[model samples]
Target: MSFGDLLHQAGGMGRFQFIHVTLLAVPILMMASHNLLQNFTAATPEHHCQIHDRDNDTRRLNVTEQPGPTTELLRAFLPLDATQRPANCLRFTAAQWRFLNPNATGANATRADVEPCLDGWSYDRSEFASTIITQWDLVCDFRRFQQMAQSIYMAGVLLGGVVFGGLSDKYGRRAPLIWSYMQMAVAGSCAAFSPNFISYCIFRFLTGMALSGIILNGVCLTVEWIPTNVRTIIGTMNGYCYSVGQLILVGVAYAIRDWRWLQLAVSLPFFIFFLYSWWFAESARWQILTGKPGDAVQELRRVARINGKKEEVDKLTLEMLKCTMQREMASVKSTYSVIDLVRTPTIRRITCCISLVWFSTSFSYYGLAMDLQNFGVNIYLIQVIFGAVDIPAKFISVLVMSYFGRRVTQAGSLILGGLAILANIFVPLELQTLRTSMAVLGKGCLSASFNCTFLYTGELYPTVISKVSDDEQKEKILLQTTDIEKTKPTG
Candidate 1:
């Protein structure tokens, strides 16, 4: 009998499968939190150069005791940019008290000599009580550091996919996934308590690496254990969990305005995930293919017992597992590598197309998702809208794909998303509602594109090349680095 028959004999999709899938899917909810954590954790608040101590005293007094005259007093100490807001990087060399006169126009204020913020900056803390930006003073000249931190984190993610993908194939999914849980918990917590920007980035990099490992191995474990008929449904459900997580981040970030506390809140749950992860059985298919039929038999029997098929599984043995998976093991003996992806013309073309799709989808997806502050709305409200759109978008995508097919679904979503993004360029900036709507539309379509890409890419690759190709596919996440510079907000 084939392995599928063996799985049926062991009570496929029974109680054990339910629990296994539930536990595995729970961790996925937080994956979105980590992926989009920077949106809240690094939010730049309104800031301006610090005024001299004497002028600062006057400003403070004006804020607390006398309000009207302090408006003009601020003009004496700070220069207004084109937007007529205080310039973020410059301060008057000495207070131009003349500008405090009510008749002094903005033109007269512009003539005052200014210098770089030599002392420091003062941030408006109405929205965020704390963030990496405020904590580290990553404003003006240091603003690029914010994007640099995210790039480093994405680099770690790229490396983790390469490292853990092969390691899971060699070692086993459960082990790497278990280790990844602990790593995420530890690294993310460490990032929360990081004493400096460099340390925070380092910890976040490790957290990103662990995130990749968790995702890669978690999917492998879930797919390998479950019956094939239900795989698509289960996969879609897991994707939904990530969408739910985006909404969860909005609530948590709103409640805890401090970045460190927010980071800790999202991270500590992984520790619970790590603790229970030890209960998971390794993939029986992996065990059999790797020449451990004895262990595979044991695991299958354990699953059978849990699924209430003890009588049927009592007859199971190592010989039966080896006999059933003999062909699969034989196939495993032949190795594949990156070179094989392009060794043939057809495969080469497929690889290139899949890579491009992955790159573009991720590029546009993160570019919009990461720049929530630029949307010119309440960040919490915009985040909620962004998260909410994904639910409908993914649901529609699944229906379209089921009815129309993968190619049509994938291509249509990308085209629609691109048109949405392009349409924004011609719209007037003053039309805030229209701009926000268009952005949300583009983001949702891109999210749908991402959903289609995953299933489509998996179907396109042959089994022999699939594993290697999946790893290579993840490597293309390096394309995310290019977006760091592209998405930076302009003055």
Candidate 2:
């Protein structure tokens, strides 16, 4: 019998399982928050060139409340777009500012020589008090650096996923998880105090590594403890925790207003996770598979005792676990590494298809998530709606996956998500509500696809290779998501 089957015989899907899933799920909220923290941390708020004469004066005015003299002067000093809004990148020289009249002809305005922002920039502080963009001046020429930071973080996640997935398979799930939690806590806390953008990127990368371990191993641990019948429910709930965190982030970002404090607020709480992780139970199956039947027996006994299954504990013993491991070992044809995922023809085909699915889901989901402010709506309200839609999306996804199975659910959700995104192309810019609605719908569909892709990919692998190879493939594909998202805004 499989380890999941054995777990089923030992009082699976009970109070012990509930507590396990919940504990694993709690950290997911933190992962969710950290994954999208860039949305606020690197947000590019309204900014403009700081005219030299009014360096201090400009800082005091709201973006909408442009000073009368400065506004009139800017008409001469700044080039206008077709909409008549001042161009963001170009400003006339100081001499041009002095020579201009309020009633200067359009021809005279055209004669002014323009230059890039030379006196630095001022930002609108009404919505955000400060962000990484303002903190390090990551606008204009430095804008691509922020996008690079996001990609760097995602690359870090891929690195951690490979390392920790192997560690979990070799050393067992629980210990590496504790280490990941600590890694995230320390690295994230340090990031809040980053003095420069490069240091901040390094810290964020480390945090991403920790986040990958938490997400991969957390899901693995929870899946091993539950029975097959409720795996869908528990997995769906795991995805919901991320949405819960996203919802919480909308509130937290609104309250914190500053990137450093916001980073601190999100990072410090992870120390609590590190402390709580001390109580986490190791995976009983990992114990048995690695030739530590004694530890496996003890873990099973603990589960049985907590679940009130005394008779089941009586039935479980060291010798039985050893024999079961022996049978499992004998049945395996050969040991395989992550390389085998593409080494064989059949495995290679499956890997490529599933990797594509994973790539698309992650690319669309995060790309939309990171650009939440670009939709031209009330950002806070849209964030709430985007997050709120996940609740029903999960519910509907569970229903569809349960009835129609993984393949249909994956294809259907992706198609629907594409349709929703395409529908937005026709939404007139004037209809902000319609555009926001379509974007939210697309996000919800992609969110559902994201959850289903994990479930489907997990189901595709053999139990022996499931923990290591499968997760690595998914992470490898997910790593490309940041690279893909890097190109999205330009398109």
Candidate 3:
């Protein structure tokens, strides 16, 4: 490219701005689309128990009268031949609510004192855990099958992380991104139409496996694209974009109550992402060091152009080509190993503590969010509440990380979330207003911590965890447990 041409590329601002926004927006979009998985199983379909009679009769179960809570609870412990069924909540006495769980080792747990079972044919998200396991098929297989599906997906992510992360670094970010997105879109759509349990599990597994490639590297690609000055803000903001993904699930699920439609809704848009490379460049940092300085220079010229710098573009681009190649090559040659992450006393301590923090935070955050449906509120209302909190929590995160470093802010958020979860377990049902209030606070900070961890992990691992690092084993471990989300749903 000529000097003036370079200058023109940089000087002209109109189209370049759009390109920058478009390129950076993918990760945000990827993160945004993540909500479909996170919230799907938490959502349940409208169902009710069909009371039946003893064998030798083909008559459908009668619902001539609306049964009260007691009848509902004792309906489980009765003889089908009984002449009459009691409809009062008082009929079940204090014995049965505890029996729903049937394994609670606690004494004195009864309908009045225990959590109530939901009846009727509407969504009941609070029972997501129970519903998926025991409430499904009225035989407890619902929750069990739900657990298996999620577990398989998590397992796929583990494998994908190994396969994809290496491929991302080895082949450069663009190719795997192209391949995986296409696969995910197809697999996700197919999963919706799966006719059997095995088919659903297989397709969903492929969907997540495909996703691990894009979402994991998308963040790295963004980091490499932008300068360090505002990386935190950019990454966190991108993380908050996950709210958009969740919101998408909200709209889709609300509109299409069937799981099959929801599955189709979640997985169909990534085809455009498969074509993203036609308009975008690979990570310039990765390219320059990978002995593709000329290509990297071309990409940088585009970025500089987008940034609207008109002066000495070709000269600066050439200089980068010469100097950046060697520096980047040297850095790549020294690619990190896990040993470097913990070789020093300080490094190891930081690594251990932070790893613990990441694990604990992930475990608690998902555990709580999945349990939100069990709180006896409207599932839609609960979702709206949780989602609404995420926005403010994101806002606070931008401010908090600005005031304090990532470490401090993350620690504080995790601590608060941990305490809140503990507090919620003991909060009385009568004081449910306060219980919900605590839930809001806990979930918000938990959401914030979840966001904060991504930013923190990216910063903490630096050369070690970034594609820059060569500690394949360490990365494998990290990715193996990466999602750390609901392995199995609990109602």
Candidate 4:
């Protein structure tokens, strides 16, 4: 019998599976918080150039018994921009006291000399008590620094996926995952207390690296333990957990209002997750394929006991494991590398297609999700709406996949999502309602596309190529070994 039968004999999908999946899924809620954290933490606020001390004195001396409005006073020191709002980056070199007159127009305002904000800038903290933007004065000339910080964090994410994915294959899923949790806790908390922008970016980059490790290893562990029949449903549930996390970020951000505190709030929970992660059993399949059948048998027996199959698993031993996994072991004897992913024409084609799909979905998804403030609505409300849309989007995706099939669902979602985003370009900027609606639709479709891609790609690639690569070679050899066994004669 195959390993699936062994799992069936050990009380499949019982108490142990329930608790294991639940515990593993909990950290995922926080994953969304980290991914979308910048929405609140880096939010830009209304600001203007600081008035000079001399300008302040001049205003005091020039005040009449009945002072003019604040807007009128600002008009003397700041020039109006194209939008008729006071300029944020420039101010009149010398106060134009004439503009203080009630009927004064800005017809000659362009003739007045202007200078850059030499003193600094003043931020309106009505919405955010503080953010990266206000904390470091990342406005006017320095605004691009904010985007640069995010780029650094994303670079860490890209490298982490490659580094951790290979590390898990070599060292096993549990170790990398445990280390990831601790790293996230430390790095994320350190970022909250960062002394400056550079230190903050450094900590955020490390935190981004840990994020990939947690997600990659977590998914691997969850999928490897459960029955194959339930994988799709369980995977979708995990995706939903991420969606719920987005909503959680809104509430926490609204309540906290300060970037440092909000960053700390999302990070500290991983310490608890790290503590409990040690209790997780390593994947028995990984253990056996790695030539640790004895450990695999022990872990299996433990699982059986927890699932209330202690009596049935009494006969479960190394000998039984060796016999059942004989073919799997044989297949792994031949060494393979990551090149094997594209070694064959069919596999190569599949890899290229899926890569493009993943890239497009991610590019579109983050493009929309990260620009919440541009929607011109309350950031908190818009964030909630974005997160909530994922729920229905994912649910409907599952139903469609179950009926119309994975390929159709995957293609349809991407097309519809791209169309929605494209449609917004022609719409007038004045139509905020239409623009926001289109963006929401696009974001939801992309979310569904992500959900479908995860399950679809897993099904497309064989387990050997997916699971057994080492850091040096970066390939999945264990599943390759199993596939070899399937081809053997049944004498």
Candidate 5:
């Protein structure tokens, strides 16, 4: 019933406001990794990769053997030519040649190999089921289904980005953002129940519609409320929150192997989040600039109160409002339309370049994460450790992003991520310890890109259109990923 207080992304918010907005970074971090493709498709098994830990700063990694030496045993399960090297790599037995865990042989054996597939002892291992397409055994159509799930949700995100961003300008940031939570609740719950390819996809697409707002609007909402000097600190800490979510996800996955339950665990929280809508207030700066001068004044009063200011509400004047709006408008070159994105050379260049970065970052980032689930590592531990890597990146971001610059900081993150990914191709899999260390590093490296993307996106977009959620488009994306399971497949 009440607009809590007016807030702005870059400047004009007080001390208390800064902390509140900083918390929004958590969700932005979560959404970046919460996709079905990421949670389900990107998961790895406890067996696949050889755990070569190049433990120290040295090149030599300690080697360890285990019962499920999947990297050594599951090579033939995949179609990778590199994995099938005659001399070097650990090789997998064919499905027909699968044997039981050799560790059960005796008490004296320190390390024994465990073979997963037993013809007579078949079990429902979803991660293994996915290998049908990954290994080329299932044909192109099944693979297409996987890709389609990824693509559709992303497309919905694209639409939501524009629509929700614009809506922030046209109506207000809070309304659409809060509304998105409602959609997320419904879409996510439904997505959990999706059975067939079509039905699963539909629910995921709807989830995307809700997702569309989470990043753009949530961050925008926080930016509106926090102070500038500490913004990056709060923002990066938000990145840390996502890793926490990842850890949370591991617990959820352990309890509920089914895709539906996983979706609910993540989605249902938003339903609780929706209640905060009543506690939120429209951005006073937005209100004032968009011609709602009286309401803006009221909001500014509330903020002044929260920050412990002694100033009376009646003391707020049109002069202060004018000064704030003037500051915001100074940066605007001209109003941009969707058409202007292509029509204007600079806007087009920036848009297209960022878009490519977005697409590439998303594809590779999600791709690698999904790919890891198939890598034969301990899924729970891998997920937890993977989430753990973000800690350093978040710390590094806080230190360098402000001192250097967003462009430089972001470009470096991308470069590092790309190099790490490419480096994975050359590492010998028989050197299990080294391989795991490298893979973990690669995951950590790529996560930096995600952090940079959200931070960069905030700096680039104009305030008004930045937080709108494109409902229809976002929904489309959510549907595609509904059928995905957290257990990734290995060939």
Candidate 6:
């Protein structure tokens, strides 16, 4: 019998596989947290140019706290926009400040040319105490740095997918998987104490690198162990875990207003996961393919014991395993590379089509995710809703993909998502409620598209190139698209 056939006879889709897949889901949850952590950690709060109160009189009169004489004085001289809100990045000069008085009766204040903030920017600490924007002053002319920091992190993910993908294919899945978890833990922890933006980006990049391994290896490990028939269910369940984690992040960020503490909070979980990494089982099939029949047999026996099938597994001798490994190895070739994916006409067409789907899905999904506040609602509440909507969408995608097939579910959802995105363009800005609803609906459809695309891609690719070639290409496309989006001015 083939290894898969043997595995089916041993005990496919049993308690052993279920528990193993569940353990693997922890990293998936953390991946979601790590991926979207930037939305809060780099968020820019309401801010205004710091007025230099030389006399130290206005320092205590924060307008957000309470209005006072000092507050009125600063408001009179500070440049106001068309909406009458204080200009965040510009202020009146000291010479102009002297002529303006809060208590003067009918005194005409001469308009002065606005200058860039000299002292610093004052942040509204009501929602957040410190973010990358507040910590490094990535506001005003420096605002691009915040988005660049995010792109830098995504670049790390791109590179990680390339490097770790090869390493996992070369080495067994377990070692690379453990190494990625540790790297993420160490790098993410260090990121919390980053003294400057440069160091933070460096650590975040490393964390992103490690994240690719977790994703690539974790999914591979779970899928390899489980029966092929149940791969879709498991994959969808993983997506659900990711979306649930996104919802939980809303509370985590809301409670921990400081960016450093939030970073620390998110990173610390990886340490626990790293320690639990010891229990992770190596892929028996990988061992058999790599010429380690002895280890493969031992792992299979262990799995059988865990699933309470020792009686049937014991009847299978060492010779049976050796023969099965030889047959598997004889049929398998080690001469594959990413170039071969496009070497054939059929594969090239498949690659191009899937790549486009991945690019568009990622662009719309993440763009909508990051633009949650643009829905004209509370940012935190909107983010929570966005995440909440994804849970049902993920489960539904699995059902639809299973019943309606991959292409139909994938194409239909993508079309719906695109339409939902265009819906926002025509909605009147004054109708905030309607616009927000459209955005939420669009996010839900895009979430479904995201889930379906991944499932479809998995079903489309041959097992040999799934983690290596396809994942790398998809992540690179996502990073490239997101980087371009970040360069555009925020609406």
Tens digits of per-residue lDDT, candidate 4, 310-381, equal: 797888988888888886666567655778779766678878998889899999999999999998999999
* Candidate 3 residue-wise lDDT, 297-344, digit = tens: 777676675676645456656564655345335555545555665765
RMSD of each: 6.5, 6.6, 9.1, 5.7, 13.1, 6.9
Most lDDT-accurate candidate? 4
Writing each residue's lDDT as its tens digit, candidate 6 over 172-270 gives 788988998899999999999999999999999999888988888887788778876777677778888888898778989999989999998988888
lDDT of 5 by residue, 257-342 (tens): 65555666777777777776546767664575466777777767776776666444455666655564564443243343566445
After best superposition, candidate 4 residue 231: deviation in angstroms?
Answer: 0.9
Query: What residue runs in model 6 are displaced by over 4 Å at the alpha carbon?
Result: 54-72, 95-110, 325-327, 464-491
Ranking by lDDT: 4, 1, 2, 6, 3, 5
Top-scoring candidate (TM-score): 4
Per-model TM values vs. the true structure: 0.92, 0.87, 0.73, 0.93, 0.68, 0.88
Provide the clash count, candidate 5: 54
lDDT of each: 0.83, 0.76, 0.57, 0.84, 0.55, 0.75
Of 5 and 6, the candidate ranking higher by TM-score = 6
- Rank by TM-score, descending? 4, 1, 6, 2, 3, 5
Count clashing residue pairs per candidate: 0, 0, 15, 8, 54, 0
In model 4, which residue pairs have backbone atoms overlapping below 3 Å? 331-481, 332-481, 464-479, 464-480, 468-476, 468-477, 469-475, 469-476
Task: Give the distance in Å from residue 192's predicted Cα in candidate 3 to where it truly belongs.
Answer: 0.6
Residue 282 C-alpha lDDT in model 6? 91
Query: Which prediction has more favorable lDDT, 3 or 6?
Result: 6
What's the distance in Å from true for residue 115, model 2? 2.1
